[model samples]
Target chain A: MSPRDLAIKDLKTHDLTMREAARASSGARVDLLLIAEMVRPGSRVLDIGSGDGELLELLATTRGCDARGIELSREGVNAGVARGLAVIQGDADIDLADYPDNAFDYVILSQTIQATRRPKWVLEQMLRVGSRAIVSFPNFGFWRMRLDLLVNGKMPSTENLPYRWHDTPNIHFCTIRDFVDLVDEVGAGIERAVALDASGHPVRFNLPWAVWNLLGEQAVFLLSRKG
Target chain B: MSDSDTTSGEIRAFEPARGEADHPHSAVLRFGADMPLQLDAGGVLTPFQIAYQTYGTLNAARSNAILICHALSGDQHVANVHPVTGKPGWWETLVGPGKPIDTDRYFVIGTNVVGGCMGSTGPSSLNPATGAPYGLDLPILTIRDMVRAQAMLVDHLGIERLLAVVGGSMGGMQVLQWAASYPERVFAAFPIATAARHSAQNIAFHEVGRQAIMADPEWRAGRYLADASSPRRGLAVARMAAHITYMSDSSLHRKFGRRLQDREGRTFSFDADFQVESYLRYQGEAFVDRFDANSYLYMTRAMDYFDLAADYGGVLANAFKATKTRFCLVSFTSDWLFTTADSRNIVHALNAAGAPVSFAEIESDKGHDAFLLDEPEFFAITRGFIDAAARAVGVN
Candidate 1:
């Protein structure tokens, strides 16, 4: 049984709320121990906005990993198939360009790549189904969200940017050096980054990388594939 | 099962009645009958005693052991003091110290299983080579002889490996028989609400509570504690038919369905005209004032011969083939006697035994006693599956 155990057995069958289905489909709140140590224990994940599976039940409980999410929210794929997990809801910018490539050993995408309208064709269909992907977000050059949009210019309510820039869906806001120059303009290679800060913690990595490359509030990357 | 003991010279000799002195958090651990729990009918159970309670401090690398397992007439008092009804350890809601099984970070342990009578050893002790009591000579026990007497109490506490092994009903059948009988001696396994098998309507509601404790007559055959004759009304009608399978006919239609028990009308004949029959007659007269009617018929036939895929060959992922031991398996959508299709058949036999399983069902109207209550979404799916199996077994 593999399409990654039939996509985690259709994500155990979808009941939703990994925190509000990963904040109504990736607005964030996952970190389940750095996604169970970047999905290793028995690898083969894929997630990409999998809500209510809480990062596929924290990579099937701390990396005995064998996930399979996808999600757009059918109530977060029926609460991640009532906790038997193995999601699928669909529409990761046109159903993750129909799978089949590396097939997955990572893929993730937390906080839904700023509510994609095609964030680089859903990061090129999460780098064509996996050999590592990850991503995360919410940086937008943080320093208190660029001092609340350069002092009182609106849009940046805090507590991990709680909406209201005219009903915010956060149309792709970037940062950590514009997402490391969009993963070096699509070639892909980072292999780990992290960040966090604002009450979420993490940050330290021997400072002076220009004040955490402009006030890190939340980032996470991890990429792969290029070389 | 016949051997009445017949008031052997007017019985009543085993004592221990002080007062106000059973509360070092909770204690009652008499090893008694010189530690004899060897029985599978070849019989040899000298005297008996096992009312336990322990929490924290076993570590100097005794790999922070943990074992809770208590259900049909639970005992050992896991997180603290419960010396016979002084109350306070029926899994004091997911066990103490910052909960989620933290007892200040592990070394827990809880006894009372070999056909329980609060303390272990069972059939109401005493039989040192038959000087009396081993009612039907103890013997019969099975959740793998209660995990081979909790692996002989984790080899009397030298503890090799066990950072986790929790339980829920029949203490999740001894945490799925300690991850299918010592899969590398259990690293983590939760097993709430339970069911690796035990249906046929929960062994026909445990054969109507072991035929209402062998139809009482102060249950003489199993020697009703030799002669003070204690089948407390057929063990309070077998704890009121196993407390109506621990609730959820919509929690007895939202706690006490047919209402009226404190005088509303129906001075009605057979008495208790409702209020869930005076709350199942106060949960079967506070469960026969703290259990034992042949240790609730040998702990409901060791949770009716628990299944763990009928001991491997029938494949519940071949009892977790080639294990790494990480499973979670919870279920509650009003627990229809261990439902959600028995935790999706133990997550499809731990995904057809490739192992490494995790599952949840939650929702809850608190049936199958929602793992014993206050469920913050079943405590955030058990703190997100033990903080992702304690960050994948690094365990800090």
Candidate 2:
């Protein structure tokens, strides 16, 4: 069976137990757990670029949220739908605008921002449609990426950023500092932000922004419209 | 048939011919002179009967029953062998022992609509007062009436609530009507390739078909049964036009595309020189053999008059405000008749009412008939939606 089919089958067989394990596993991806933590129980959520709906199922079962998702690829949507997630095949850039204002309690764009054609507009629409928005993406200014560019003289690829530069879907690559600046420029308030290391754990709880930007391999931010 | 006969197993009734019977697959629900159906068009239909078929076995909780609403030209032979066509049921692809509907898990019911000719209390049925076919004298039906009749049947079956109500096209309208009319009874709803109200262009097409049927000389003012004649020609033309609407332009072009008929070249006459013409002609000819003319008119009229929002003071969300039913709307990308926008509109209303709803726009060039076709995306979405709803309703 394909990886997607296996993932769906795994979900169908395991249900809540597997999800609980994934949430509690220290080896689990920190971004997914952090996003799940930020969302309140019984809230309405829309997950953009909801790949195979792993997070969607987590939210619905663990958090008791009314979860819906919009996945870009047919395969991802099929996998999600087969696992009984309310995932529709849609483009995040074009379909996000169709949602009504304040339609969801939380709108999540997880590790998919850099792939979007219009990342800024997508964030703005997410804020407009949801009371709060959560976004997570791989940081391009990690120390290893800088060293690779400085020593190897080529674009960097890490465990999180697995694709080669030419074939990568990360169109608008952004560092932790760059995303923070962009969020400020867009007039949104950052409610919480976490910079994670390669092992999927926070780099430093009380570090300076520049220090965290240099060492953090990935970042997650909770944002809301500025008053 | 005994009362126990109607409750379990297959019970055939009213089978006069192999394919020409009123009710073929199961027992008929006969209403005496005391219990008359009060129609919206201000007429009383009495001494009537409703023909229905069932699949799977009802669970002890009686909570695993699903009501499958048939479209304009559909009948109660869902998930089984169709008596008239001598073929598998119309939805056999998605609804069977192991298919998406999973007849092995749920007790499925499909009833002939009130205005349908398939053994239901339609224009073709006999009127006790006149001792003849009701024909034009039959009260104009609506989607709500059909749903009400289904509710009566559900009551008779001792099912307090349905796990889900599912349908496509005109059948979808009944699903929506069930949600709106009896919010508590319908636990979940799947309305595919349908809109809250018929589009103006759709009404125009129905009007043209009605005019065709009415213009036939053999119609005899819908008294053709008494004269031992039928309006075959007019019904054929009507079906031909409606068939065109069911298919997409791209599909027709791909299937026919000015291809020659049987002969190599045109016969220099108005004959069916092109393959598309011949195909449509065959469709029309085949349709007239099974359908009744007056029933066609009534069914189309019922579809045209369906406006759920109008019944709820012009706000679609109001109709669903009290509804606890979970909804899933499906539409084809290339279906101009009931486009994705229509499903989106319904989704928005459901959202406004704080109802749980999902919408899927399956990519297909099969047009409105995509619901009836073998679209994998549609099947997956349906399976997912139904399974989730089943879990919610405690259907093991």
Candidate 3:
């Protein structure tokens, strides 16, 4: 079996103690694991575009956090709700404004920033509603994507960004550098950042922002509003 | 389980009735002088009776009881066969054994409101003070008064708190009233396709229906029952007009369109040429058979007077201040009568009051009747909300 399949199999067999330890340490995708580590135990969380509520479920079961989620698809909301998580069917672009300021400790938009109509406004709203926001997205400026465009003269489609241009939901795709510039423009500070390779493992630490942007297949950033 | 297992002290087993008119599953509980229902219209309703039906079994702790409020024309016939029409219950789509308001697990109760045409005490019920029907003499009832009567019924059933109060349309209005008036008594509330107050357009339509009923020569100023006569034509017209409001334009067009009724082409006369007209006539005729004109007026008026925020100094959030009851508000996109904005307004107020709330706007073309239809999304959301609330109340 593949390593991903093996990790999932191990997670299923482990009891609560082992499951909690595996979740707190590392088990699944590196970005999600990193996001889980940044969240404090027992804090309130709101996961926007929380497809199937995997992160919300993890936070609730492992960290004992009060987790809520807003998903765009009815099926995802139904699945999340059936698992006893407080998830509602709503659009991130429209429903985010309804939440009160500072309502959650952490607001997460994992792997969904590029699909938003107004990514900057959504990030700003996330910062307004949460003390800290965590965002993850596929890096469009990866070296392989750059090379594929240069050699083949076409939009690159990799495992992380696997959709064709016509059917892709990732409108307004941005690189890590572009996202950093947006964070600066929105008056938010990046508290921490992680660049994950193609195999869902973080790249070497202490790399400059430019090198990380070019090499990272995907990126996760922990952001907070600048006073 | 057998019938005996389903029977409890609060609910009797369903025994076959002697006559066709009697509801085998219904129980009529009377509130005499000792328990007078104080109305919002400054009148006391004494010696009144509430007709209700129970399904499933109420556990020993009674934390599994769910109270369902009926809409304007709905009665206590929620999940069983309707006695009068001999058809399935109104909410059978969502209240059967394995449905959203699952009768297999939780005990479900549906009550006829105070001012309803059903077995409940209303304008048709003879007043104890006089040897005649109350008619107009029956004090104009409000939504709060109906909820108050239900609370009394709940008290009589020995249930201190309801696991959830649920309903749609005017029924939903009663659910909100239950949450607002007896916040501590409701563990959860699901108010679907209803507004905090009746919109002016709704009141206008209701006024038109009321005018139609009163204009009939046989009405006799709401005393047709005493005169041994009925305003059947006027009531049917009123029903026909109101039925159009219950559906969306697309639904009507899809169901009837401009198709000729029982013919390839129209006769060109003023007869029921279109299928829509024939359908409305059938609805009107069917409605007049089971509904009373005076009771219809009273029910619509009750809905018109429902304004939770106005009662709480015009601030909707004040109505839900410190409420521990979890709420799930639902609205349909095609329900123009009670738009999604109304449910959102309620959600905002509940949020501002620090109440745990969830809202869903289901995409439907069925209009206000969407709540009563077999909408899968609505069913899933309802089941999820009820299951979560049941878990919180320790109902397994």
Mind giving the per-residue lDDT tens digits that candidate 3 earns over B217-299? 97899887777667887888999999899999999989988998988786979999999999999998888777878888999
DockQ for model 1?
Answer: 0.05
Native-to-model Cα distance after best TM-score fit, residue A200 in candidate 3, in Å: 2.1
- Selected candidate, larger lDDT, 1 vs 3: 3
TM-score of chain B of each: 0.36, 0.95, 0.94
Per-residue lDDT of model 2, residues A1-227, tens digit only: 22233334333433443365565774445578778877889999999998888898889987999898888776677677667666666788887877778989999999999999999999999999898999998898888999999999988877677799899988999998899888987888877777777876665445567877887888888888877
Across B1-396, the per-residue lDDT of candidate 1 in tens digits comes to 111111112222221111111111233433435665565445544444344467777756566667788878666676554554667777777777888777776668886666665445566655566655577666678787777777766765567778778888778878887888798888778888888888889999998988888988878888866565677778788788777888778878887777888786888489888888888888887777666678788878878877778676776777777788777667778888888777766765665554655555667786897787787767665655554455554555
DockQ each candidate and list the results. 0.05, 0.29, 0.28
lDDT digits (tens) for residues A147-179 of candidate 3: 999999999988777899999999989998999
* Distance from true location, Cα of A126 in model 2, Å: 2.3
Estimate, for each residue in B260-342, the C-alpha lDDT of model 2 and write its tens digit. 99898989999999999999999998887778888899999999999999999999999999677888888898898888888
Residue pairs with colliding backbones in model 2 are: none
RMSD of each: 19.0, 6.8, 6.4
- Candidate 3, which segments miss by more than 4 Å at Cα? A1-30, B1-25
Report how far residue A103 has shifted in candidate 3, in Å: 2.3
Q: Each candidate: what lDDT?
A: 0.68, 0.82, 0.82
Pairs with backbone N, CA or C atoms under 3 Å apart (clashes), candidate 3: none
